[model samples]
Target: MRADTVEPPARPSAQAPATSVPVPARIAAHGASAADRVAVTGPDTTLTYGELDDRADRLAAALQAAGARPGSCVAVLLPRSARYVLAAAAVMKAGAAYLPLDPATPADRVEYILGDAATAVVLTDHERAGTLPAGPWTVIDLDEPRSLVPAPQTPADPHIGPDSLAYVIYTSGSTGRPKGVEITHANLANLVDWHNAAFEVSSDDRASQVAGLGFDAAVWEIWPPLAAGAALHVADEGTHRSPQLLQDWLVEKQITIGFAPTLLAEQLIAAQWPAHTALRTLLTGAERLNRRPLAGLPFTLVNNYGPTECTVVATSGEVGPEGNHPGPPSIGRPIPGTLALLLDEAQRPVGEGEPGELVLAGPHVGRGYRHDPERTAERFVTVRTGDGETVRAYRTGDRVRRLDDGRLIFLGRLDDQVKVRGYRIEPAEITSWLTQAPGVGAGTVTVLGDESGEGERELVAYVVASGDQPPAAAEVRAFLAAQLPDYMVPAHVVTLDALPMTPNGKLDRAALPRPAVVAEPAASPAGESTDDVKVWLGELIAELLNLGQVGEDDNIFLLGGHSMLAMQVVSRVRQRYGVKMTLRQLFRGPTVSAIAAEVAQQQQEASA
Candidate 1:
């Protein structure tokens, strides 16, 4: 079913009831009282609540001194560091909306966001300060001596309303450009309050910050802790790759609360939990939470669901061995102070057991998009129920069924939205880039190849060669490099003579061919010189391809070595030989001996 094209139920009400809150005081109150508590922990540094608040105050004062007006957009480009959190808080404190520009984002994309938002000021560290596109805006570097100057104390502004824009998050737009979703301070405050009350976050709780600063998940990673006087431990980029290191850090830091998507949680589960960790709450969201990942984790496992436009989260459910039931756990019930309804195409409430689009209504709803009024009107609409009451509800493009017990069961997305690395992706956007390459024709992409217990889905693309010319997979990848980000690009591209069609004549994605397997080479029968290297490559490829007798000349891609498998191969290669091999190297040299030789050469050069 086409999700975005599916017409939603008509609005029940002509107008939505106004639900807004005061913004500045909420943050100030939390900051003032918990200033001395630990707020953020990074690789080798820790910022107490007091330190964070002070830094934010200084930054806000600087912005205000530079003539930044309330509601103005303040763009931030930085890594996942403590400064990013402080800068966001500072933007809110200054009564300006924060726009997080992810460092990993392409320069052109970042320029588009800054221009669209008409950013008044930008706060970045020295490393990324010069990377921003040329613009007429004040730039403040946190590392500079001038940035350390403390401005006069600006009292908390009580005038900032809940409906005021707190931040703007840009989603991967299917139409080739990113669209910004404007979230208000009131919306964030409501979400934080809901989480604090529901999860019972206390001053003693320590939450882990794993998601990137640019995503909505970061809100959950940052605010709940500050609001509840709890601590937040920021995981470094390297920690995300090493499950063992992450597990050790989680235990050593005594993190009581953290959230990861089911994929990462499954990885942790597979690696086995460390003996010393004391995790009280393990919240999973941004994707479906399967049962296997939560099977033996000694903590409360919460499966959460919500869109970026609806604050951090709107619904959550607890999962455990005793309560384990069925395929995927229910999304549970609406969060406190939130209303969830299942409605059919007619905007009528669906009866129990009937499938419908899930609609969310509450104060946690964001302030709509930044500059796209038409797009905003299309997604966010007011719906009236049978009771003749009006509420502003976000039409979540999710297909769901109301369970007999009132819980909502996730069916699937009603649109092209797919989760990759816990970030929502629109396949159309990725396909647009793929089709731009020379010799490329109609391209249809779908996420297939999910591990038995892992919730992560691997993206695979099926393309019909244009006319008589078909572009090589490598060339297509090179073409995509300039047009799209790494995550959006398909890991595997399969050329098809013609796509299979359903009875209705729609493309039948299930009939696509899986990549052919190629045998990796066995060790030379002549000598012991290459024994250990051959043995290692054989074991790695065997585990990846689920086969033995891998020939030396066997191509990795032909053996079904996609990006994820390539990463696994690289990690194992690095661990065994103490040498690094890039993803490109693996693609170029798909054989054991070739890759081993390349690594050996690099090691020799380093030693020289």
Candidate 2:
């Protein structure tokens, strides 16, 4: 049998377990032995091990008095801070799963999540208490002095077992609403154990917490280090946005370990660093990595791959320095205690090195989506192993191919497949090739209708320039034509200063601007082409802004054009004129006449 084609490992016995210690219990043990050590370092405050334990214990008692139980779900709505970690630990100590809610979440969405989870208690700061929608749950403001009234000095020890619910994280649902995923203590414990052992986390290490409160990466960032008795430094909002600022902060804090989303990590590894630094390991996931770090890097760059359904990570490998390989590094083999299988549509194992759906079975798998039995039944199923043992598994809709050494390379999502002109295309493959083009920093591809609503889809590419001069549309197309089929080349290539991203650091596809209509009436006379372009662009702007008509010299911004709308206008101009138009040009001019003059000049320069 081929090495990569080996059958899945034997199913774990029901009586055996992956981890013997729960997360809360580990934190308590650390508090006893390292009471004076700093547990959390926030922007404005610091908490010692004793203080964190006592405060969380007091909060847990209050929650219990407020009628929280072993199976109840508590809601935590606070910004990233020392209190945020305290609240999560308190909920687990009270024997209730904590549901994270970002304060910035829309009020209606927050209301829906609270109602759906049947949350009985909500933990937040006093300043943000009024922001919450009126709900049936009891609110406890951690900032209020009365809320922490004297309680037992020791930690609260409720009956929290491996089977007890740990946390319920909500993920974006396909139906435009969010679904809560229930993770048990066993699942969380396995992650904590694996993280601590894999990363060599210890009390002397200082880790950074950069993910938001609602993202699943935040859970992974918070618990692993704290449970191991290390100090977790909370990064400010600005540090997370700029790669240079983040690297400076990491150096200033002397952080030994850090985690960033895939996009940010790609930028961070490419940025310059000091000759010697405290950082030893950098972990990144939540998207496919497109580039490898250059040689002579100080730290080990580890690329990880997994869905929220299977804890924070299932496969991980250290990415070596950039090499002559044609593609990015492979997501390493499955972690211990986890079994991964690649199966086709018929549930049969695919041949070696063939792409198939990634199915995971083990203790790391989440219990299932909360209040979504149908979806749970569909995604999480029982599969019989080659040895005839049955194990519950989650069918990750992601496609992957196994390497000879058992490493997996992430293909695009099964649902994200696009069909253009009777040919199936994976946009990720195109994006990867675009990023490899000269003078291109990053890129993404999207599919949109032809604007006639006839259901004809075309691929639109957006790229960021690595230097002052952006790659011309013709040059980019020629480059892609060499690496890809003719049909796979994008119909429109729009260059931008940067790609739009969510607060959690994932690509925001819905936020991508749509390409403009390419069909325009030609000039009536040969000498009137520039005037014709101005008139047509003015009319297009008016139509997009929902105005009856716009004057040639009117400023679009003053006429209610926002950043998103500006991007749309730029996309239209780039496609129509075949020029490398950017948002800066629109912001500088902000009028139809000014943009038309610049466009005409660029066209003249191109001809010259």
Candidate 3:
């Protein structure tokens, strides 16, 4: 992993995955990393820097032989494993861009991405191979030895330049489909450089990978540590899903650097951080961070803000300690080399007190959305700089006002799109799904509840029935649950006679009615012994959400309990019961009565 700047081997000979001092990763020459350090680690697997470099070299030679080259898109559908890292590195080594696809996504979505990106090859495990839609892609199964058997035992570091595409990450589109953002190697390198400098990344640091492959944040997770000669601990699916398990995993791995989405970060911050926790830095982004960081945290928490168009991060701020925060912390200034412009609706610079669109211009900004020339032209525009040089910039839809102190304060989105639990989502996408559902005619999804120092802001779907009876709320909920992620699914689907509209025929957002609370009450646990525990849990949950009362049978999330509130529950339960209640258990059984049962089980086991 040591930066061996000596001219790279024209064709670095590949042995089977093996590493010694001087790892010599293909990216290592350009990336200041150490060779002997552990490059990637999973729950059961670890790949040394040298091994990772060699394996990627071997695989890159194979990919080049199989008709892949620079500018080609190679999709990887493997889960979070050593192979996932190997495949991504291999693609880059082959001078081709890596297209990461979540195997958990619906097949149709996967198919769309493959075709849209013109994927040249697919590197996946046997479990996911059978499901890939047939295409021009040369499918290779990681489980099968034959996939790598024919590869030339050498590395092919093709002529890769900064402008060459590095990866294409798809984000939710306003038009009901996802748009792929094309990022180049230069963009990646710039981000890696900024990350290393900002965090003081080093070979001694152990970073954790929690973001899924399909996410852009995964780029930050995979690259910086490897480039900085650090060990990257891959969080298993369970650990990534369960805040309780993720915290424990970080401690067990002695992770020093970690990144999580806004929702999960809140829970991790609020949790009972073990005294031995080794995490020193935590990076969180992707949604609004409302909670003031708590005191006594061992790590420095940085709230980052960025659009996928601008690599992974744009601005970052280390939140102040408890009780000293002036307000919701600002997004801070731009990173080194990036320029943030606050322009008003007229394209003129806005005053410090005025809100304007945050336009970003830098080497880190992505090449623009793939295959969508119109959108690319609209979003990524060329502007004359103060130095009289022309540079491309991305128009971020986020509205922000600059403070007199030079920091930027984030105002809510200026469009219909909203971020729910760290996922950038379009209400139109949900409405599109709803309008397609049986018995639903016109549908509109809007955010409800005040988020600023108030209740949880949640999505509400208002629908007009196509048939005599409006679609059953449960039926609509089930329909969405089948096709979309949990975050995209509306908590309540309200049926109305007709959607309220303005004189101009647009939906009047302010006139949307509140969701009628029609959820059938869950049966309360009716035993005498557990009543006290249930009552206590109920009070704790009620206090967290500021509800009048939380029934023993009620689901917290249904009653507007988001990840932030859920963490408060976990924290409060631990303080009261001296029991470590997990986020997984809460998700499994959110009701107070059910949690009381889990607490009892954990206690009995601990005693045993």
Candidate 4:
């Protein structure tokens, strides 16, 4: 179960020659070969290589015709679908930088990103086009099937150099605004080449697109396969939710390579794979990888580490059973073209076994954040190494140590930035909102997750109530919804009698409650209608709350069931019985028995 590191593989010979074209051209060149295959699979349909290329070419032509000039920032807002991928390809092909907009992002946030980036146009499907904010921006609908009228082949614009910007990915900003990271063609190409070469990828290899297009991980998922002439399988939202479906899709499509955050990987492990699975290499990054779930997987698991400033990844290590013994496996050595240095606050190299900030320098380093010179210069700086080489290193803000074996062991962030479900969450922003909630006393919130040196952890909130009566979980959640996004909300809320403090009276995060997992019991014996409903409702509530048990009168939201989970319970209730109820109705009733009575009443009304 241990990975053996042999000497680095021989690089491609001078005669073999690497492709010098930008990423879009490289993809086009690969797609030109009829034999080259790129299949994007979704919940309902799949597109072949020819179809994908044709669609992208058509969209690119359309973009050009629609006045999208070179270097223009074209915002893209679409769900995880083929259209999203094709639109991205189109934007690149049109010689414009694609700005990704996450569907789950708030409308105001989307507006801020678009305005901040000064996007010239937006390419989205019919489903999401209307959701865009009202502006003087040009929008292209890719969902509408247009005739693939071959446009005049515009000669490859040689002016677009490798150093030119390719895309701008916006990360959640700590200061109430989002910051866009400008990634260059060279940066992306280097990462794609490194990943493909490191994994020995081939045209036969198939990879999964699990992360959303907005996430930096999606860059790894998309470009690597296309650059290597391999296949990229796109999984829809539902497919991503069900681990079994993901495994089945991977097996059915013969996926040989894939990447996901540690959170999604843990879900795959919890779902329990079949006796056999066909994953050759599973890459996890953007967050720390837990060792427990990765132990028995029948694939070579690699832990990739890097910030968005370092393109996709700077360092990667193979996870194995032997390496799992000493806490967790190392973050592995730097990739071939990358140099990882552990530097102190003064930017001096820290000794081996001493913790310091991780700094990265290489071809994969991205250009500083778009249009934010002050913040950009703060993090990205030039430093002279002990070897007397001056290189631009990105201060990752990740605390780490160089182990005796030359691998880096990640400790945690020096800042308040924490990773949840693979996305970085700034505690300052979350706490800013939590402290403002009415009835909540001066509150200091801390994020706890599996990456926090424990098992898979969700967000848990420990609040100090203002008065004798504490606000309900529903009210707190409602307040959070107005300020924070869904993923940033704490999954569990513990109304602490008082906030725990450290020896010096600082907020103690370690004392927070770990998310409790509730298991479902075996089905009960056939019984009276009311008793049967009570047992079923109790089990449902327990599962919803992630609690060991639930009483008939226990309030659902009070036990940590959020609005989303309330809807899920309602859906499950409808599926079990031929009855339907709305989330509002569930909130009003607020109890399992109450919901059951509503369902029973609805069923009776329908029958009558």
For this target, which candidate reaches the highest lDDT against the unseen true structure?
2
* TM-score, every prediction: 0.70, 0.82, 0.70, 0.70
Pairs of colliding residues, candidate 4: 450-457
Give the candidate number with the greatest TM-score: 2
Model 4 TM-score on a 0 to 1 scale: 0.70
lDDT of each residue in 1-608, candidate 4, tens digit only:
22333212222111212344577776666767843365566654666777767667767777776666776789988877767777788888777888988776778989989988888888877778888887767877666655234344442342568877789998868797989999888888787777777788888887888876677888888887877777778876534533345677777766788875664453454344555577877777755553434356667667778788888788887765533344545677787778888899999988767989998898878889888999999888998888999999798888887765567777777875778777787665565567557676544556664676556657766554555455666788789888788998877665543343322112345554443421123444433376678788898779767799998888887786653465456645654564545544675688878987886687678768
Question: Residue 156 in candidate 1 has what lDDT?
Answer: 46
Q: List the residue pairs that clash in candidate 3.
A: 1-23, 1-33, 1-34, 1-35, 2-34, 2-35, 23-35
Supply every candidate's count of residue pairs whose N, Cα or C atoms clash at under 3 angstroms: 9, 0, 7, 1
Query: Residue 189, candidate 1: how far off, in angstroms?
Result: 1.1
lDDT computed for candidate 3: 0.73
Look at candidate 2 and tell me the lDDT of residue 242: 53
Residues 1-608, candidate 2, lDDT per residue (tens digit)?
45323322211111222565888888888888889999999886899998888777888888887767887899999888788888899999989999998776778889999998989999988878888788789888877878656545444467888889999988899999999999999899888888888788899999999876778888889998998899999987556755656788889999999998877787777767888789998988878888777677778788888788888788887776665344666777788778888889998888987999999998899999998899999999988766777889999999999877677889978898777888888889998888777777777888888634468788888886666566777788889999999999998887765566666668777777665432333434424477787898789899989999989999897797755577667766765676677666776688888889888888889889
Q: Write down the RMSD of all candidates, one decimal each.
A: 13.3, 7.4, 14.4, 12.1
Residue-level lDDT of model 1, residues 474-525, one tens digit each, is 7877787777778877778765433443221224455555554221233333
